[model samples]
Structures are given as structure tokens and as C-alpha cells.
Target chain A: MAVLQAILDGLMIGGVYAVISIGLTLVFGVMGIVNFAQAEFLMLGMFVAYYAWAWLGLDPLLAAPLAFGVVFLLGAAIQRVLIRRVLKAPEVAQIFLTVGMLIVLENAALLMFGSGFKSVSTPYQTSSLQLGPLFISVPYLAAFAMSVASGLALFLFMRASWFGRAMRATAQDPMAAKLMGIDSDRMHMLAFALGVGLTAFGGAVILPYLTVSPTVGAQFVVLMFTVVVLGGLGSVAGAVVGGLAVGIIQSLSALAFPIQLQNLVLFLVFIAVLALRPKGLLGGAR
Target chain B: MNRSTLLRGLGLAVLLAVAVATPFLLDPRGYAIRVVCLALLFAAMAQCWNIVAGLANQVSLGHAAFFGIGAYTSTLLLIHFGLSPWLGMLVGAVLGGIAAFLISLPTMRLKGHYFALATLAFGEVMRVIANSWSGLTGGPVGISVPFAPPSFAMMQFKETRPYYWLMLAALVVVTLVFVAIRRSKLGYRLRAIKENADAAEVIGVDTTRTKITAAVISGMLTACLGTLYAQFQFFFDPDTVFGVASISVRMAMIAIVGGIGTAAGPILGAFFVIPLEEFANDLFSSRAAGLSQLVFGVLLIGVILIEPRGFMALGSRIRRLFGKGGRP
Candidate 1:
């Protein structure tokens, strides 16, 4: 029963992880550059949602789209101004440029919002649903629902929309997509915007449960990377699978180990996966 | 030797003379000398990073794992068994080397971002362990080097002058080692691997073995510096020592800013970055906490955008613009 309950809790949190990590993988898929600062966008989203709730009396779940929209614009600008410059640069430049952005974003937040941890008081914050032998927390359930909705929306966008097809075409072959009269640069900007926007959306949904801080990204940096890498970098479906797996792993590890060892468990699993399946469990070149 | 080489050699000798004479020029217990000592210590750390990232072309982002290992190993030994830090440093080096070897076994084939992430995970693992095992590490409150009389054996001193000299000697030793490695057959193998791993393998270069050797050496040297840092700071925590941004990125960033794969690059970079950081902290720390870090971030981004090849390339670019005696 405990195992089953852990799995249920893991599934809920893992859905949010998938939503957050999808942006990372999507950007990598399209641009072939890993955005080390991707989680900072999540931080920004949480702030957006927190402010929306604090000032507007709007529920965080309702503020999710606002969070996504704001981050989408910021991400577009970042992709154009910063990432565009590094498309042709070396790997070190790409890595450090994002790292630099990460430091700047985190510190800028510290300067602006101060270094205090912020959390939202939702009506559903303490509510829970009993599912026979297992229990599901309301905040977790709401976040999971939002994640699923967003994931489905993204799936539809990729499958049925022109912009989504163009993005995918660019990811598959940039040169060929260019030949097809698609603006590869614009596609890159769109992909980056969508990716980070989705992560921001996830951030807003989970804001009710997790405390928001300038340094919150430190907690997710390895977690998100593990999700993407476990499924496969640049693979959207892989991120989803990886996210759920990581969430399950974390929850299961929690049952056995103390809270501090949670990251240790993730690290060990990450190393083992890298050793056994260098590509990922899904096993794709991307 | 070529004219440029001779000129460079003379320039280095003069620089060394100046560095040796720096403590005398500054106050014995002044903050400036302490900063210089830190600069020297960081320069050594950066050079160790350069051996792997610059020459071996394996850009590790978790070197702080070894650094923290060295720091804690020696600090713990001193606290518990009354062991000299010198012996603890040796033990730390072995532990660090073994840790490096273990990590490299899994990460040897991973390159670029994959390698970075894996090593980063390794570092976070060490940090988590240190924080959780409060019985040994004292947890997040941090640990302090026990105060004792000025003694060489304990690696603790009351004045900053002796520490400055010690750090300078460490930097000199590490820099010499870097130069020796670069001139060795192993260095050539590393360079070849960096250029084309598959091609190197076809040529029977044993790419994995060469990379592991460089990583172990780098890890051991970084650990040794960790001991030096523990003694110098008189206190540290998992976050400061095993920190991804603090130790790992700073080392890699310093190496990049100076000149990747060049012996003088880390030395030049350390001098530039460390002093600038101190200046920023001194100026803005009271008014704004993260302002200095923000400035540091901006500088990194600017450096990347302007010239990813770093100061060495920028210096030559300036010379080229003047139509002066440069590479051309």
C-alpha cells in the first residue's frame, strides 16, 4: 500500500517535472544548444504567478497562462539577442553563455525580489483526496492536471499546427527547412519561446506546493537535466518518460532515505544510466 | 629558441620576480595580500582544470567534488587524529584521484554537454553527502580550521605573508607540472584526442586511458589545492568548497578567459578574475548582495560574445590591428 501510494505521489510530481523539462529538451531539439539557464525561466514563472496571486487575488492555476505568456516573450527576446549570437560559436561559448545568463538571472532576482523564500496560500493547499488505500494531495493533483493539459496542448500544437510543423522540420534538418522557405532563425526563436513558456506554466501550477526563491533553480538544474538525459536529450517524449521516472525514483528514495540524500540518489541513478545506456532508456541518437 | 619565445620567457621571469616580491610590497596582514594569495591559489586550481578541459578537452563542471574532498579529508583528519595537513593532503590526493578515476570510467565516452552534466551530478552528490553527514562535516553551519600557534607542520599560520608565499609556491609548482604535462607524450595524446577522438583511436592512442590519466592528475592537484584553501580560509562548507559555480565554473571560466591549453593562460586569468571579484565584493556587497555576481555574469557573457578564445587571442588581435610583431 505504501509503495502504491508512493507511486501515485510520484506520478503527480513527475507530471510537473515533465512539463518543466520539456522546454529544455525542445530547445535542444531545435537549436542543438543546451540552455543551462532554462530553469531560471521556471523561477521567473513562479514569481509571475506569485505576484499575480498576491496582487490580483487570482488563483495560481488561473495565473498559469499569464506566467507562460510573460516567459514566452522574455524567452523570445533572449533567443534573438543572446542565443542568436552563439549559433555559430564553439561549445564552450554556448555552455558559458547560458551559465552566465543563469548567474545574471538568479542574482537579478535576488536584487529585485530579495533572497527570501516565497509561497502562495491556496485554498487547496492542505486538501487531499482519498483513493482507497492511496491518498492524492490537491495541490499535486491540480498541478498534474495542468501539466497534462499543457502536455496535450503541446502535443496537438506539434501535430496539427503550422508553427509546430515548421519547428519540427527545423529540428529534423535546419538546412532543408531553410530550403523549404522556412525562416530557421524565426523557428529557433519560436521553439525557445514555447519551450521556456511551457516550463513557466509548470512553475505556476506547482507554486502552490513549492516555495519560490531566487536560488530555487539550483534544486531543479540537476533534476531537469536528469529527466531529459534519462529519456534522451532533445527528445520530447523522452523527457516525459524521464520526468515520470525521476519523480518515481525520488518518491521511492524518499521512503528509504532522508531528505538530503534525495539528490544523491538522483546523481547515482544518473551516473548509472550514463554508464549503462549512454544515449538513454529510450535509445535515440537525439 | 624563437625571438617571441625568448621574449616571453624573459617576460615570465620578470613576472615571477614581481610575484615573489609582492608580499613585501603589500601589508603583512592586509586584505590586498590575502586577495593576491587567493589569486595565486585560484590560478593553481585553474591550471589543474586546464590540463583536462583545455588539453584533454574534457570540460568538467564538478571539479569542486575533488576540491571539497581534499578540504574535508584534511580538516577531518586534523580535527580527529591530530594528523598534519601535509599527510592529510597526500591522503586527500589519493582519494581525489580514485574519485576522478571512478567518475571518468563512466564519463570517458561522454563529451561536451553530456560530460558537463555527468560531472556536475558527481559534484552535487559529494555536496549532498557532506551536508547530510553532519556527524563528520558539521553540516551547513560550516567547519573551521582549529587555531594553533604559527607552525609549518599544521599548515596553519597567524600571518597572511607566509600563506601568500605558500600559495605562490603552490601556483609555481602546479604551473610547472602543467608545462611538463603539455610537453610529455601524454600531452600530445590528449591534444590528439581533443582534435579527433576517433582518429586518435584509429592511430592507437588509447583515448580513454589518456583522458583518465589527465583527469586523475587534475583531480589530485585540485585536491591538494583544496587543502591549501582550507588552511587559508580557516573555514569552509560543502557549498563553498564543492560548489558548482564557486570552484568548478570559476576554474573552467578562468582557464577559458586566460587561454585554454596555454601555461600562462590560467595565471593571467586568475590575476584578472580574482582581483576583479574582490573589488566588486568590496564595493557593492554592503548595498547589494548579488550585485558582484551579476557583474561577474555580465563579464562572462561579454567575454564570450567578444572573443571566446580569451585574452591571449584578444592580445594578439590588438597586435595584429597595430601591424606590430605578432603571430603574422
Candidate 2:
């Protein structure tokens, strides 16, 4: 019964992790560049939700799209000013710039927010739905539902839209896309914006449960990176599967072993998976 | 070749003499000695990182893991078993090297960011263990070393000067090894792999063996530095050991700014950036220290934007601008 409870809880929380990582994987797939600042987009969303709740009495769910819109523009500007400059440079330069951007955004938040922890509160703080002996908290249920809906929307976008096809073509072959009269540059911008939008949306979805602070992004980004790598670098489906697997393993392992060893399990799993299958579960074999 | 090499050696000797003597001459006080100790520590670490990151072209963000491993291992051994730090440092180095080797075996297959993330997870795992393993690591409060007069056995120096000299010794030995490796057959293969892994492997470079060798050596050196750091500060904690800021501040600013691959770059980087960082801290109030980090971050961005190759490349450019003249 305890194991089952842990599994249910893990799956609910893992939904958020999957949403966060899907954004990361999508950006990497479309742009072949990992945006280390992905977490800052999440941070921006949480802040938007917090302020909207505090000042205007707006619900967090309603504020999420607003956060997504603002962050999308921010992401587009980042692409224009910084990433575009390095689009043709060597891989190392691209990595350094993105890492630098990560540092800059993290510090900027620290300076702007003053390192205080903030959170959004709603009416369903302690509400839960009980299924026999099993229970699901309201925040977790809402987060899971939003994640599932967004995942489906993302899948549809990829499978059913002209812009999505253009993005895919750019990912598959930029030169070929250009030859076919698609503006690969515009596609890259859209893809980056879309990824940032996902992170923003994720932030708003999970804000009620987790506290927001400048450094919170780092903690979550580390987990998201683990998920992305575990899933395969640029596979969205892999992220969804890997995120839940990691979430279950992490939560359940705490029950079976020392709580201190929870992270050890994750690290060990990462090593094991890398050793056995370098390209994650859904990743293309390299 | 001999003449230029001789001149280079003389110049380097002069620079070392100045660094060694600065504490006594200017009496910039023990604060300067403290800075030198830190700079030496970072130089040693950056060199260790360079073996794999620079030479082998595999970036590991968690060299701090080895540093932490060495620190915690030696600190725990000394605190619990009353082992001498001389022996402790040796044990620490071995432990750190082994940990790194084991980690790399599984993670090295993943390219680029995946490998980087794996190392990061390894580091976080170490930290979490250190914090939760109450009996061994003392949990969040950390362990403090007993102070004593300068002694060979304890590796505990009474004064800052002795610590400076100790770090200098480590620095010299590490630098010599670094230079020796750079000129070795293995070094050539590492360069080949760094430049192009497939080409190197096709030409029979044995890239995996070379990367592993670099990692072990790098880990050992970093661990040695960690032992020294604990001795200098007289304390060891999981935060100091495994802190991302601690490693990133040193490696990212110094190594990245100095020149990622050059022998002289990290030293120049330590010299320039560490002092500026200290000054930035001194000039600001505690509450406003974030501004210093902001400035530092901006400086890093500016440097990256203007000169991605860093200070060494700039130095070469300046030399070329001087019409290849001998030193004025």
C-alpha cells in the first residue's frame, strides 16, 4: 500500500518534471543548442504568477498564459541578440554563451528579487481527492492535468501544423529547408520561443506547491537536465517517459533506502542507463 | 629552440620568485598570503581540469567532486582515526582518483552535455551524502581541524606563510607534471582527440584510455588541492566541498578567462580575476554583494562576446601588434 501510494505521488509530481524537460528537449531538437537559461524562463513564470496573485488578485492558472507570452518574447530577443551571433560558430562557443546566459539570468534574478522566497496561494491548499486508501493532492492533480493537456497540445502542434512542419524540417536539415524556401532562421526563433513558453507554462502550473526564489531554478534545472539526458538529448517522448521513471525511482527509493541515498539512486541510474544504452529509451541510436 | 626555451624558463623563474617573495616584501599582510593560497589552489585545479577539459576536449563541470571527495576523506580519516595529514592527503588523492575513474567509466559514453550532467549528479550525490551522513561528516555543521604549531606530520602550519609555501610547492610540482604531460606522446593523442575524436580514433589514438588517464591524474591533483584547502581554512564542510559556486567561480572565471587550454592561462586568470573579485567584495556592503556578482557576470559576458579565446589569445595578439620585437 505504501509503495503504491509512493508511485501515485511520484507520477503526479513527475508530470511537472516531464513538462519542464519536454521544453528543453524540444529546443535542443529544433535548434541543436541547449538553452541553459531554460530554468530562468520557469522562474519568470513563477514570478508572474506571484505578482499577479499578490497585486491584482488573479489566479495562477490564468496568469500562466501571460507569463508564457512575455517569456516567449524574451526568448525570441535572446535568439536575436545572442544566439544568432553564435549560430554558425563552433559548438564550444555556443555552449559557453548559453552557460554564460544561464549565469547572467540567475544573477539578474538574484539582484532583482533580493533572494526572498515567495509563493502563490489558492483556495485548494489542503484539498485532495481520495480513491479508497489512495489520495491525490489538489495541486498535484491540477499540475498533472495541465501537463498532460500541454503534452497533447505539443504533440498535435508537431503533427498537425505548417509551422510545426517547418520547425521539424529545420531540425532535420536546415540547408534542405532553406532550399525548399522555408525561412530556417524564423523557424529557429519560433522553436526557441515555443520551448520558453513551455517552461513558463510549467512554472505557473507548479507554483502553488513549490516556493519561488532565485536559486530554485538551479535545483529544478539540475533535475531537468538529468531527465533530458536520461530520456535522450532531443526526444520529447523520451523526456515524458524518463521524467516519470526518475520521479518514481527517486520517491520510492527514499522508502526502501536511506533518504540521503535518493540522489545516489538517480546518479547510479544515470550511469547505468548511459553505459547500457547511450542513446536513451526513445532517442535515436547514435 | 633552446634559446627561446631558456629565455622562457628565466622569465617564469623571475615571475615565481616575485610571487613567492611578495608576502614578505610588500607586507600586503596575511590577506595577500591568503589570496596567494587561493590563487595557487585555483591554478592547480584549472590545470587538473585542463588535462581533460583542455587536452581531451571533454568538459566536466564537477571537478569539485574530486575536491570534495579528497577533502571529506582526509578530514574524516584525520578526525576519526587520528591519521597524519601527510598520509591523509595521499589517501585523499587515491580515493578521489578512484571515484573519478569509476564515474567516468559509465558516463563517458555520453557526449558533451550528457557527460557534464552525469558529473554534476555525481557531485550533488556526494554533497547530499556528506550532509546526511551525520556520524561521518558531522552533517551541516561541518568538521574543524585541531590547530597546532607548524609541523611536518600534521601538515598544519602555524602561519599563513607556511601555508603559502606549501601551496607553492604543490603548484610547482603540478605545473611540472602538466608541462611534462603536454610534451608526451599521450598529450599529442589528447590534442588529436580534442581537435577531432573520429579522426584520432581512426588513426589509432586510443582515445578512451587517454581520457581516463587524464581524468585520474586530474582528479588526484584536484584532491590534493582540496586537502590543502581544508588545512588552510582549518575546516571542511559539505557546502565548501561540493558547492557549485565554489568550483564555478574559480573554474569558469579563471580557466575560461585565462585561456582554456594554455599552461600560463589559469595563472594569469587567477592573478587578474581573483583580486578583482576580492576587491569587488571589499568595496560593497554584505547586502549589496549581489552587485559584485552582477558586475562579474557582466564582465564575463563582455569577455566572451569580445574575445572567446580569452586572455592568452589576447596576449598573443598584443605581442603580434608589437611587430615581433624582443621585450622592450
Candidate 3:
């Protein structure tokens, strides 16, 4: 019964993990560059939602779109000014550039927001629904629902939208996409923006349950990478599977170990996965 | 030796003289000397990183694991068994080497980003363990080197000058190792692996063995530096020693900013980056909390944008422009 309950809780949190990790996979898919600063955008989203809730008395769920919109522009501008230069540079340059961005964003937030943790008070913050032998926390359920909706929306956009098709084409082959009249550069920018925007959206939805701080991104850095690697880099659907798998792994590990060892288990799993299946469990997909 | 080689040797001798005489010009207890010590230590760490990352093209982001292992190994030995840090450093090197070998066995075949991701996770695992194993690591509050009468054997000193010299010696030794490796058969094998692993294998290069050897040496050297750091600062936590940004990223950054694959790169990078960072902290710490760090980040971004190959490359580019104009 306890194991089943843990799995249930894991799925709820895993849904949001999928949403957050999707952006990472998407950026890698389109640009073939892993944005190490991807989690910082998630931090940005949390801040945006926090401010909206604190100042306007809006719920984080209601402010999610605003968070996405704001980060989308920031992500696009960053891609143009910084990431574009490193597109053709060596991998070391690409890695450090994102690292520098990570440092800048985190410190900038520390300067602006101070080091204190921020949380929003929602009516459902302490509420839960009982399901026979299990209980679902309202905040987790709401965040999970928002993640599912956003994930579905993203699926539709990718499947039905012209821009999405163009982006996929660019990911497949830039020269071929150029010959097909698709603006590869524009696709790159769009993919980066949308990728980070989705991560920020996940951040906003989870704002009710998690505290926002400048260093919050550090906590998710390894976790996000595990999700992407497990699903395979650049595979969106793989992120969903990886995220749920990670979530279940985390919850189950929590059952067996002390709280501090939780991340240890995750890290071990991550290293094992990278060693055994570098292409990801599902194989990489554009 | 060839003319260019002799000239380089003469230039290095002059630099060494300057480095040796620098402490005499500065206050022994001053902050500037402390910064210099830190620069030298980090420069050594970056050089260790360069062996694998620059020559072998196997970029590691988890070097802090070995670093922390060195710190904890020596500090714990001194605390528990009253062992000298010099001997503890040897023990730490062996352990760090073993850890490197263990990690490389599984990850040696991985390339580029995959290798980096695995190593990054490994570092985080070390940090988590160090933080959680409070009985051993003293938890998040951190541990301090026990104070004893100032003596050479203990590796503890009251004045900063001895540490500066110690760090300089370490840097010189690591730099010599780097140069020696660069000139050896192992160096050529590493370079071949860097260019193309499959091709290197086809040509009879044992790619896995070569990579594993480089990683073990790099890890062992990094762990030795960790002991030096422990003795110098006298206090450290898992976060600072095993930290991603503080130890791992900073080591790689210094190497990159100076010039990867070159002996002088980390040296130049360390002298440029560490002091600038200290100056930023001094200037902006009072104004805002993270302002100094923000400046550090901005400067790093600026460096990458301006010249990803680092100051060494930038210097040559300038010299070439002038040389061409003068000749014409």
C-alpha cells in the first residue's frame, strides 16, 4: 500500500518534471547545444509567478502564461546575442558560455531578490483529496494538471502548426531546411525561446509548493540532466518517460534512504544511465 | 636546444625570478598575497584539468570529487591518527587515482557531452555523500585544520609567504608534468585520441588505456592540490571544495580562458581571473550581495565572446597583426 502511494505521489510530481525537462530536450533537438543554464530560466519563471501572485494577488496557475511569455522574449534575445556566436565554436566554448550565463542569471537574481526564500500563499496550499487508500496533495495535483495541459498544448503545436514543422525540419537538417525555404535561423531562435518558455511555465505552476530563491536552480541542475539523458537528448517524448521514471526513482529512494541520500541515488542512476545508454533508453528522436 | 626553445627557457627563468621575489614586495599578511596564493593553487588545478581536457579532449566537470577527497583524506588522518599531511597527500593521491580509474572504466568510451554529463553527476554524488555523512565530514558546518605550533612538518604556517612558495612549487611541478606528458608517447596517443578515437584505435592506439591513464594522473594531481588548499585555508566544507562552480567550473574556465592545450594557458588565466575576481568582490561586496559575482560572470561571458581560445590566442593575434604591418 505504501509503495503504491509513493508511486502515485511520484507521478504527480513527475508530470511537472516532464514539462520542465521538455524544454531542455527541445533546445538540444533544434540546436544540438545543451543549455546548461536551462534551469535558470525555470528560476526566472518562479520569480515571475511569485511577483504576479505577491503584487496582483493572482494564483500562480493563472500567471503561468505571463511567466512563459516573459521568458520567451528573454530566451530569444539571449540566443541572438550570446548563443548564436557559440553555435559554431568548440564544445568547450559552448559549455562555458552557458555556465557563464548560469552564473550571471543566478547572481543577478541574488542581487535583485536577495537570498531569502519566497513562497506564495494559496488557498489550496494545505489541501488534499483522499483516494481510497491514498491522498493527493492539492498543490501537486494542480501543478500536475497544469503540466499535462501545457504538454498537450505543446504536442498539438508540434503536430499541427506550420512553425513547429519548420523547426523540426531544421532540426533534421539545416541545409535541407534552408533549401525548403524554412528560415533555419528563425527556427533556432523559436526553438530556444519555446524550449525555455516551457521550462518557465513548469516553474510557475510549481511555485505554490516550492520556494523561490536565486540558488534554487542548483537543486534542479542534475535532476533536469538526468531526465533529458534518460529519455535521450533531443527527444521530447523521451523527456516525459525520463521525468516520470526519475520521479518514481526519487520517491522510491525516499522510502528506502534518509532525505539527504535522495539526490545521491538520483546521481548514481544518472551516471549509470549515461554510461550504459548514452543515446537514451528510447534512442534519440528529433 | 633550439633557439626558440632556449629563448622560451630564458623567459621562464625570468618569470620564476619575478614570482620568487614577489612576496618580498608585498606585505606578508596582506590580502593581495592571499589572492596570489589562491591564484597559484587554482592555476595548478587547471593545469591538471588541461591534461585530459585539452590534450585528450575529454572534458571533465567533476574534478571537485578528487579535490574534496584530498582535503578530507588528509584532514581526517591528521585529526584521527596524527599523520603528517605530506604522507596523507600521498594516500589521497592513490585514493583519488583509484576513484578516477573506477569512474573511467565505465565512462571511458563516452565522448564529449556524454562524458561531461557523467562526470558532473559523479561530482554531485560526492558532494551529497560528503554532506550527508556528517559523522565523517562534520556535515555542512564545515571542518577546520587543527591548529598546532607553526612548523614545516605539519604543513601549517603563521605567515602567508610559506604557502605562496608551496603553491608556486606545486604549480611548477604540475607544469613540468604537463610538459613532459606533452612530449612523450602518451602525449601523442592522447592527441591522436582527441582528433578521432576510432581512427586512433585503427592505427593501434589503445584509446581506452590512454584516456584512463591521463584521467588518473589528472585526478591524482588535483587531489594533491586539495591537500595544499586544506593546509592553506585551514577551513573548508564539501560545498566549497566539491562545488561545481567554485572548483570544477572554475578550473575548466581558467584553463579555457588562458588557452587550452598549452602549458602557459592556465598560468596566464589564473593570474588574470583570480585577481580580477578579488578586486570585484572588494569593490562591490558592500554595494550589493551578489554584485561582485555578477561582475565575475559578466567578465567570463565577455572573455568567451571576445576570444574563446583565451588570452594566449588573443596575444598572438595582436602580435601577428603588428608583425605583418611592420614587414610590409
- How close is each model in CA RMSD to the real structure? 1.3, 2.4, 1.5
Q: What docking tier does model 2 reach?
A: medium
Check candidate 2 and list the clashing pairs. none
Error of 3 at A178 (Å): 0.5
Segments in model 3 whose C-alpha atoms lie over 4 Å from true places: A284-286, B324-328
Alpha carbon lDDT of residue B57, candidate 2? 69
**Of candidates 2 and 1, the better by lDDT:** 1
Per-model C-alpha lDDT, please?
0.93, 0.80, 0.94
Cα error, residue B240 of model 3, in Å, equals 0.5
Worst 10 residues of 2 chain B by lDDT: B22-31
lDDT, candidate 1, A1-286, per-residue tens: 8889999999999999999999999999999998999999999999999999999988999999999999999999999999999988878889989999999999999999999999999888999999887799999999999999999999999999999999999999999999999999999999999999999999999999999999999999999999998998899999999999999999999999998998889989998887777688998553
Candidate 2 differs from the real structure by a C-alpha RMSD in angstroms, to one decimal, of 2.4
TM-score of 3: 0.98
lDDT of 1 by residue, B25-102 (tens): 899978899899999999999999999999978888999999999999999999999899999999999999999999
Runs off by more than 4 Å, candidate 1:
A284-286, B1-6, B325-328
Docking level for model 1:
high
What does DockQ give for each predicted structure? 0.84, 0.53, 0.81
lDDT of 2 by residue, A46-163 (tens): 8888888899998887787787888889889988778877777655556667767777777788888878999878998679999999999998899889888888898999989999
